[model samples]
Each structure stands twice: as structure tokens, then as C-alpha cells.
Target: MITKSIKGIGKAVGVMLLIIFGVQHVEAQQFFSYSQYMNNLTPLNSAYSLIDKNGTLNALLRKQWTGIEGSPSTFIFNGNLPIESINGAAGLIVMNDQFAVEHLTEINGFFAKGIQLGNNQFLGVSLNAGIRRYVANYSSLDAVDPQFRNDVRENKPNIGFGILYYSDHYYVGVSLPELSIRDLGNASTQRADFFRNHFNFAGAYLFGKEGDDVRAKPAVLATYTKGVPFIADMSTTLYFKSILGIGVNYRTNNEMSGIISISSDIIKLGYSYQFGTSATNLGGRLSNATHEVTLSYRFGQNTMSRSIL
Candidate 1:
């Protein structure tokens, strides 16, 4: 009798986990998202590798749903530089994410070449190639279901492409962050294929004079997945003498965030605090809040001293 009761509980847990996985896999972006995309753009759009004329190194750490167990956490690092000789730019991006029973890692290399459109205006196209590693740890479950007793790991290849148009004060970009799909392996004979085909568009505009005491910058980022509704994010930031900044972000009923940042000639530090406002109870129950931090360093000369916030 005890054996039968334990088996029933295990099955119940397995079913619950399956439902959660299905919902997340289908409704959300497969890749980890950072609120500070403006600070570190390479992870989202390869074409952004050349945003700065000089080489740039950036790192971001994000903790999502602070009070929730098995919540997602991400670490990303990227560096990019312009090759004036070739009229191109190149970058390297590495990201790792952990959530629930799954962990993912990706390493990508980006190359882009641009042509001068006019004074301070340019157009560029970029390509990214990478390998993705995914692993599921079912052994960690307290009561392992018989159907999910087997552990799974997959290593796959992915490629992406992007285009960007930018001038001294404004920029626009479009990209496909992932181009390949992988089977997540079955849990209890249920097909759980990984979602694929994500499209992203981002743009920003800067408002100020050559020596303005303050400036206002507005930016927007939108994403589309194959089967999910579109996700849009908009933000506006105010900068004081290009040194300190404050901003707010709105995510279409999903979240609202407050941003604060400080910058100098070579280093930048930023932080964002997000509040959940989704109509769904899951957003309120599972997610307490989201926090993200970004740090970046610029090498070589400081040709342009503007904040991308």
C-alpha cells in the first residue's frame, strides 16, 4: 500500500513538472533575456558589435524571481572590436543560464562588415555561429518518477544573422538570435521539442545638443517567437552630462523596471529593478522581482563619449 501511494505521488509530481515545462517552452523566449540590452548588445544582436568605434568588453549578471525556487539565473560576457583595415567588426559572446532542471551554455563568434552611408551614418550586416549545450538533471528530484528516471544532455550547433543601421545619435537593428532547434528528449513519452525561430528588433534615439547639460534617450526592443505573441519593451532614459542616468522600462503588462547607471570615459555600471505586473497569477506567485547588473569597459581612445542607455 505504501509503495502504491509513493508511486501515485511521483506520477503527480511528474505531471506537474511536465505542464510547467510545456508552458515555459512554448510561451517564453528560449534564450535568456537581460533588461540591460543597451549596455551589452552583442548577445541580442550581432550587428551591434560595431556600435562603438573602439573595442568594448562587457559582463552582465541577472537574478530572476529572487524568492522563487528553481528560478532562472544568467551570466553573459562579450567583447567586440572594429577592424578599420577591413571595414568590419568582430566579437565573441558567451552565455550560461540555469533554471529548474535544465542548464544551458552557448558560445558564439560574430563578424560584421559595414559601409559608410554618409558622414557618421553606416549600414552593416553580421553573422554569428555558435554551439549550444543543454542538460537536464532529473536525478535531483526528491521523488523520481519512473518515466523521467533517465537523464538527458544535448549538444547542438546554432547560427544567427543580423543587420544594423546607425548614425551618431540614433540606431536601428534586427536579428535572429537562434536559427536551429533541438529535441528536448521525451519525459514520460511526451514530445518536448525546443522552441526555435526568434526574431528581434531594436532601436534607439538620442536627444541633445553638442554640449547639452541633459539629454533624453528613448529606446524600444521587440521580440517574436513562432507560436507566441509578440513581446515589446520600451525605455526612456535621462542623462546628466553623460555621467549619470535614470530610466524606466515598460514591458506590455509584463513588467515595469527602474534603471540607474553611471558612466565614465572607460567604465560603465548599471542596475535595474523590475516589478511584475502580469495578469497571470503565476507571474505574481512565482516571481517576487527581478534584478540585473551590468559592467562594461572600453579600450583604446574615447572617440564618442555618449551613453547608450
Candidate 2:
């Protein structure tokens, strides 16, 4: 009887969370995030298609809230390259996110062109076009209410834009990753805001020797969404001999993380561990840390700017 009661309560809670997520997902932010954003650019800013000189490929995987049921997980794969014939840059991004009964998959293409601003400084403008495929399963609910729908799936169009300015020592960018809002269907025939516009501001600077000397980089990323509080992150990283890197980061009112990475001519590997803060402070002490891993490779002979590291 006790076991049955516990199962019943779990299902009830799941149903409630599902309903709440569905409602909030429309008006609120419905995006996946990574703690180590420094290594990634195109995910937030389409203009970053030209951030690096060599053709690049990157993959990132994140697992949030280990040991927790219905936790969130995200996976992303993206690639970018400069097209000398077109005198521009192009990229492709694919991402998958899953939490509880909700799943989101996105496939996007990016195009960017840069304007020289003298002294090796440049400004870039970009456009992104994509599709979002969303899926939800309500069959897990113990009691299927009339308001609940099962196996909901949808495909929606998405568009975004960005601008970036950069030199050897510093870089700044602003982006609207989701400029077009989408309406996900509701059970009652009333359409709700399924996707909202997301604005992102990001900047980074490098200090120390511009050549072979050790360097320190500090970076920040801020995001804003309608009807939701703003979120920001700050981080500092140290690079040794342009091959190894170590860093720490703090997400405002969220969590703290440590990272390590190794880069080579062939590939780069990075790993991060995040400890929860605030309400999850106690839970973090119980080994429920979030984990993330990243892999990136650069090909071709074109050299990337050293100042943007």
C-alpha cells in the first residue's frame, strides 16, 4: 500500500510539472544552455560563423542534475567554415534537448559576412534560418485528464540575427537567437506562445602576451527573455602554451563550475563540472553535480586570430 501510494504521488507530481512547463514554455524561455559558452559562438550568435579562421567542427554534451528523475539533457553539433569563393562564412547547427516529457530538436543554418574596420578590426552581420521540432508524451500520466493530450508533435519555422565586433584583444556580440515567436498548440484549441524571442550579449577579452606567452581571458554572457528574469554568467580562464586551459565560472544565482581543456592541431577536448548553488546547495553536497563534455576540431591551414582566445 505504501509503495502504491508513493507511485501515485510521483505520477501526480509529474502531471503537474508537465502542465506548468507547457504553459510557461510558450511565454517563457524554452532554450537549452551550456555552462562553458566561451568555446561556442554560433549557438547564440550567428555572426560567429567567422570567428575562427580554420574550418571547425564542435560537439557538446550536457547532463544536468544527476540522480534526479526527469532531469534535463542537451546535445549539440555544429560546424563552420569560411568560403573564399563567396567571400563569407557559413555554418550548420543541430541540437537536441530533453526534459521529462518534453523534447526539442533544432536544425539551423548560418550565413555571415565581415567588413574590415582597419587595424585588423572587423564587424560581422549574420542571419540564421532554422526549424524546431517539438515532442511531448502525456501517456505517462496515471489519470489522463480531458485537458491532456498524448504524443504531441510539431514542426515550426525559426529565424534569428546577430552582429559582432572583434579585434585581437577583445570581442563583443549581440544576438537574437529566436526572433520569430511560434505558437505551440494547446489541448483546448487555444494557442499559447510556444517560443519567445531570446536576446544574448556576450563579450570576452584576453590579457598577457599576444604571442607565445601565457594568457588570461575573462568573459561574460547575458541573456534576456520576455516575462523572465535576466540571467548572466562570468568566467575567467588561463591558457598555457596555447594548448592547455583551465577555468572557473559563476552563473548568477545558479551555480559554480570548474573546467579543463586540452587543444591540439587535430582536436580539442574539454570537460566541466558544475556545483549547484542557492536552493540546491544542500543537494550538491550529495554528489548530484552536473557534467558536460566538449570536443572540437579545426582543419585547413588558415590561422585563427590569437586575440580572440
Which candidate's lDDT is highest? 1
- Clashes in candidate 1: how many? 0
lDDT for each residue of candidate 2 in 153-190, tens digit (9 for 90 to 100)? 77788898999998767789999977665555642132
- Which pairs clash inside model 2? 26-193, 168-307
Q: Which regions of candidate 2 are displaced past 4 Å? A: 1-30, 85-87, 143-149, 187-194, 280-287, 303-308
lDDT of each: 0.76, 0.75
TM-score of each: 0.86, 0.85
lDDT of 1 by residue, 1-309 (tens): 788767656655764664474364225534567777765667888788776778888999988767656667899999988897877889899999876677778899999888788998999889999988777766555334575566667777888999989877888999997787544444212223343577889999889865677988898988877656677889898888888889999876467889999988788999998776754524465554789999988886654654453
